[model samples]
Target: MSLARKFATVGGATLGSRLLGFGRETLMAAALGTGPMADAFYAAFRFPNLFRRLFAEGAFNAAFVPLFAKEIEANGIDGAKRFSEEVLGVLFTVLLVITIAMELAMPLIVSTIIAPGFVNDPEKFDVTVKLAIVMFPYLMCMSLTAMLSGMLNSLHHYFAAAIAPVFLNLTLIAALAYGLWTGADPLMTAWYLSWGVLVAGILQMAVLYAGVRHAGMRFGLRRPRYTPNVKRLLVLAFPAAITGGITQINQLIGQMIASTKDGAIAVLQYADRVYQLPLGVVGIAVGVVLLPELSRALRGGAVKEAANLQNRSLEFVLFLTLPAAGAIWVISDEIVRVLYERGAFSPATTATVASTLAIYGLGLPAFVMIKALNPGFFAREDTKTPMRFTGISVAFNCLLAVSLFPIYGERGIATAEAASGWLTTVLLFVTLVRRGHWEWEPALFSRVLRLVSATVVMAVSLHYASGYLADWLTPQARLLTQLTALMLLIGMAMIVYFALAFAIGGADASMLRRNLKRKPRPETAQEEADTSVLPPPQM
Candidate 1:
């Protein structure tokens, strides 16, 4: 498949999921607002999600996909299918044990891991524990889903994996809708939301499994075996999991520190949700598709082709992410208010969330850059390098959080996050350069500089326009009209930015057009002849 088409397929599905997620969060804001109930629910929901990133996104797919791709390229589809079954059998056993243990220790895990926010309010703490218990099993379900996703992605079936997240958002929205129609208590509704996690996990796995089967692959419970393949998968997975764990730990630490300041945790979470939209669309889609493709190339000793693909993907991320960051920074406040200012989310809450969003916006490009670049290491099975670098980033985050929380409160926490993100991005770049894995690309740098100039123009124009529009956004003003106006202002800013970018040669519309118009280039089928630890054939 063409790279652009692949991205479009994944991005389209992800955007749908994100929009549905927005609906879920909006309904949640109306139902729970910024209160103890909301805090408890978020805290409860975070536990499984934190682990999901560690195991599913971070460890499992990072290790599994390259190996599975190699097997497919070497031994054909049937060989890869057997490898997947073995890996899945082992994965289920391990994740099941971990889930049961976590469910049993939910209370202690919440109170100890990231529990400072609940210390002052015992009731909220108790409720958080209860909800966490309900959601903890979601890790098992989602991890399995991730394995299934990795398989489908290897088969070039991005649609099913990308669409799986939509089910999650849909399940939550369905729960909230049911609660609203039935007039249930908010806390009970929050509980229902927790239950939806399990439901969504099951649905996501089932959808992907069906996709895999339709792709002419089948998986079943295999007799547990300690094959060399399984051993290598475990060996790779452990450090990879630790790497994912470190990143998760950074956010958990941020949460723990922010917890001491009431409402701070939720503020960061909401702002992150907004920043993550573009990060998801541009960064994640590239990372997911690039890793497997690059792995196949690198394994086949197609160093030039791998490097070319990496450089091209890097440019794509920088070109798209830079303007996205600018748009987010320019419209942070208006975006927050427009999306999240209903129900118990008052004007003050809007300002707070928006400010946090702006700070996070500053780091959006760096965050997405990491997503694009980290795959370079993972594709080569060099997960340890990224893991070590991520550890340093975690330390930077913890130190900043401690020093800033007492002075700047929640905004301070957001600032710390932004600072650490940029720091890590720079550090990673330097390390890659030193290792000769990456070199200075003058074209990419020039594009970034041009993007900076365009942002300045957009920001200056926005600063002027917002002054005249502020008066029409009074508290007594109709929220819908005011929100529409706010979006119009942002839309105008985007138009100016893009127009300036094109004029100044910061963005190449032809490149984007070519990317979009490209078609899929499928891999040539291989015979079941070899199973080496090295790479596969190039397309």
Candidate 2:
């Protein structure tokens, strides 16, 4: 399949899941608002979710995919299956031990890492601890699921793995719908949400495992042993996990800091979910497809192909994310209010979330840049470099978040996250350039600048369009009016951005079709930098 098609398959599925997430969060806003119970649940859930992102989605795939691809290359499906079973046996055993340990240490975790801020309020502290225990087992299920998802990705069956997350949203939405229907109190509703998390984790893992089977791989249980392969996986996985899950690590740091203030955790989470839409669709989609594709090119010693993957994927990411950041920055208040400003979500809450979302918008491109760039390292089996940068970014995030939160509150936390993301992006880019992994080309820079120019025009237009729609976006307006006004703003954004991009040579459908329609060829260095809409970069 073409790169764009693969991205679309995964990105389309993620879009569905994100849309469902919006529904789930919308109901959650009504059920819990930005109340104490809301803080308790989000804070509790963030722990397991953090590990889920770090290990399952980030670490497992980063370390496993290239190796899995190698097995496929060396010995075909049977060889890969044996390697998978070996990893699975060890993974299952390790996850079981970790779950047991976390459950036992839940209180200690809550007191220290989970939410030290809640300790003064004995009631809230107790609730966070209990909720975390109920949800922490999710980490195990998702970690295993991550393995299965990686298998599916390596096999090029993107849809099933991508679609599994929809079940999580479906399960949670059902849980929330039931709670809201019963008019349950916020605490009871949070309990429902926690159990929903556990159940959804199991469901998502099952779907991915079935997908692996369908992709012509199946396995039974094996003894958990530290084989040479498993040991090597561990060595690569630990660092890759840290690098892959950098965003979550930074967010976890922000969460710890945000916990000290009432309602801040949930507020940040709401904003995080909103911005995660574009990240999941574009950034994550590119990362998933690019890793396996790049690994294949490198494995075959196709330097030109690998370089094209990096540069073309970069083009694809900026093509989508720049305008999204613009939209979020331009009409954050309207978007937040439309999605969240009802029930327990007051206008004051909307203001805070909007500001946070806007700050996050500034970093969206950088946030996704890591996704496109990291594969440059992982495909070559070098995980430590990205890990070192992640450590630097996390530390910067911690220090800056601490310094800024007292001054700007939640917005300060947002600022810290955006700044750290840009820092990481610059670090990754410079490293890739210095090492010659990334083909730093002037045409790419020209396109990026053009994309930015187009985005600025769209953003300026959106500012005025939103101002004109302010009355319709007000709380007094009917729900339909709010929805219409918001949709209209989004539609205008798409129409304006894409047209301007194509007109101004920021994008070329023909060139994209030519370059990304197939893997790069040895003779296509000129094609890689064809003077279609713009000339090739000066050497």
Taken over the whole model, the C-alpha lDDT of each candidate is 0.78, 0.91
The weakest ten consecutive residues by lDDT in model 2 span 530-539
Task: Kindly report which residue stretches of model 1 are placed more than 4 angstroms away from their true locations once superposed.
Answer: 244-247, 513-539
> Could you tell me every candidate's TM-score relative to the true structure?
0.93, 0.97
**Residue 50 in model 2: lDDT:** 90
1-539, model 2: which lDDT tens digit per residue? 88989999999999999999999999999999999999999999999999998888888778999899999999999999999989999999988999999999999999899888999999999999999999999999999989998999999999998999999899999999999999899999999999999999999989888888888898877999899989988988999999988998889889889889999999999999999999999998999999999888777666777888888999999999999999999899999999999999999999999999999999999999999999988887888899999999999999999999999999999999999999999999998899767778899899899999999999999999999999999999999999999999999989999999999999998657866754666566455445212111111
Highest TM-score model number? 2
Clashing pairs in 2: none
Instruction: Report the number of the highest-lDDT candidate.
Output: 2
The true-versus-predicted C-alpha distance at residue 379 of model 1, in Å, is: 1.1
- Relative to the true structure, candidate 1 reaches a TM of 0.93
For all candidates, the clash counts are 5, 0
